[model samples]
Target: MVEQVDILVVGGGVNGVGIARDAAGRGLSVWLCERDDLAAHTSSASTKLIHGGLRYLEQFEFALVGKALAEREVLLRAAPHIIWPLRFVLPHQPHLRPAWMIRLGLFLYDHLGRGRRTLPGSRRVRFGKHVTGEPLRADFSVGFVYSDAWVQDARLVVLNAMDAARRGVHIETHTRCVSARRDGEGWTAELESRDGSRHFVKARALVNAAGPWAASFLDDVAHVKHQHSLRLIKGSHIVVPKIFEHRYAYIFQQPDRRIVFAIPYERDFTLIGTTDVEYKDDPSHPTITAEETSYLCDAANRYFKKQLTPDDVVWSYSGVRPLLQDEAGSASEVTRDYLLDIDQNGPPLLNVFGGKLTTYRKLSEEAVDKLAPLLGNHQPAWTADARPLPGGGERDIDELLADVRATRPWLPETFAWRLVHSYGTRARDLLGEADGLNALGEHFGADLYQAEVDYLVRHEWATEAEDILWRRSKLGLRVTPPDVQRLTDYLSTKR
Candidate 1:
């Protein structure tokens, strides 16, 4: 079958979804195709922070810092549910960069950006005074507290896709674009769906937003050559038992001067990581290396009261960052800035290179702006100051929570707050007019209810049980194997 659209976006990662959403909102007919499930790759495997890279200050990347910091507030306001303010405690170590440099970086970070809303600026915390500093070693007398945002990376992609679809973008999951060719005036793209269906889509413009596969898609799939090259750097993270009492995440400096984040994840686990190493292998199946694990563990062990080893790790994941090579000596030093390669020889194909989660919206807006001329009469960028995500459209979460409590007063305050944090205003959408715990149908463990699973399957495009247990929600930490089996069987029946 042959279909036509104004624009075709090839990857369903954050960048691709962002582009599709922007393009669709701009009144362009758009089609977004993802080979695997949305966010099945690097977008979901991020460090899960929407912060201005504090460490990037060392690299003197002021422009990136400003852009990210500005977007932090933009996203927090846009999706206050999944994205919220996080306080980071950076304990000073003697061996690391001196206190002066740290202070300088923090000062620049505070002043680099213009607008600040929910999050406060950097402040010095005393180990004896603040509860967050209590877990630190006695020698760590002082620390700096700065603002950043934590994002549900996977759902962020989903929210963008949802918005795109709502704004008239055709979203196809498990559909891979095998080839693309320019036919006289426009472009012809071939796609294969999950059910062994073949499709040919013709479009005025094509966007190669494939995360790690940007180069591969351009060269092999699109049959075009690119001047820029993508440098794949594998960054891995380990989820271990919660080691600290504070709600604030820790930003620790390693011996090699690389900073590792010990973030509070899923309420019960401390998510620590990220080792940056050159990865030349497949981006699809990047595995956590022992050396990276050791590096992360060592970095965590430096400041935390409890030591972490491979055995303590419950889950480990690695993501290959499709970085635009800028001739940096080390992978860690590579710039996180994205590049738009627009080819106007025929129909323009905008290939996005390197970008972090924090800067995706801006990147998308800029990308569409670049391709606007090719598709004459394109709509102006409208995503810069958008409102809440699909479920997070409301301004008041407390009001929504009160509504949820009224509906299900049996929900404990903490657990109810957890649901509110996860689902935002959509808490009622899942719990729906259910009066009590039983009305929620079944308790699968943790805060997970049967109603939530149904809502995910129906509205959020949840296919597998793991998608519900892990990515969609962190109920995997609490749900039993038998419960998971039951859910899996139920999902199978739905198919």
Candidate 2:
């Protein structure tokens, strides 16, 4: 049987799923397919920040910075559980950048975006009196404090997919769009699942939101020709033991003028990244090179009193950014802004190019605004004023945590906190009628239990151990090898 829909969205990254959610909300029949797990590649690998690019101000990218800053507040309000305010401490290095220049950049960041009501603005801090100073080198007597937000990057993608499914969008993960043919007034796409089962769908419009494969998918899979090109820039990050006990994150500026972040991760580790190297290899399997690892370690060592080496790195990840190709001298200088190219010569086709995580919501809204009108649908733009994503209704997460502990007194403090932060109000759904920890089922190391795993598999499209451990939650850091094997065995039986 050939299914029909108003739109066929290729790719399951933030941009793709965000577009699907917007289109579905407008009463359009939407079908989205991904060649791999949602956020298996680029989306999962990020510095995990939601902020206006403060450094981009050096390049005079005021508009992009302003747009991102505005979206930061919207996202914080929309997903308070997964997104929260974070303060960044930038150590003073007069040789790299003058103090006046740094202050000017931060001032613009604080005032550029219009609706900056919630988060506190940037300020200067005396390291000798600040907690962030205790971990810094002695030379760093003065630093700057700025406000940003942290996000569970992978969970954001899953939430968008979940919301799209609720709005009648069909989401197919681990399913590849083998070929797409433009028929008279629509597209007939051949989709292949992991087991080699084939299915067909016809749609009025086609959307290519494939992140790194945006250009390749057009030439090889869809067999369409376009002039757009993507510059694949590989960024790598190394995770090591926590460098400091403070809650504040550090943004270090290297001599090369590129910035690297050392953010607290998984409650026990520090995430240091990322080196910008032009990549020509397969985007699916990007690994952190030894040189890149050394670079990150050295970058962190420059700022923190606790020095690091390559051996200290417990885990590392890399992602290829499909940035828009501009005539930039260095890969790091490439613009983080996005472009939406729409072809109206025949059946409408929209191609999303060169976007950052901070601006994905606006990018998706713009993509739908352009493509939705062409499909004979005049649904007004939404998603800005819409209700929060699933499990994101509660604004005060600390209060929610208090309530969870008050009600489920048997649940450990750590376990209850993780639940409220990860699943928000839906944590109640996972607990169900369970009265104690035993009812939560078998333990899988750390605070992970079978009940949580079941909820993820049933709701969040978690398939493999990595998806559940690294992406869905950072339990991989605490789980032993045998525990992971047990999880794999359990998933196999369920399959």
Query: Which number leads on lDDT?
Result: 2
Relative to the true structure, candidate 1 reaches a TM of: 0.96
In order, what lDDT does every prediction score?
0.86, 0.92
Measured against the true structure, the TM-scores of the candidates, in listed sequence, are 0.96, 0.99
Q: Which parts of model 2 are misplaced by more than 4 Å?
A: none
lDDT of 1 by residue, 143-234 (tens): 88998889989989988888888899988878999999988777899999878889899999999999899998988889897787989999
Candidate 1 worst ten-residue window by lDDT: 111-120
Residue pairs clashing, model 1:
none
Measured by C-alpha RMSD in angstroms, how accurate is candidate 1?
Answer: 1.7
Clashes of each: 0, 0
TM-score of model 2 (CA atoms): 0.99
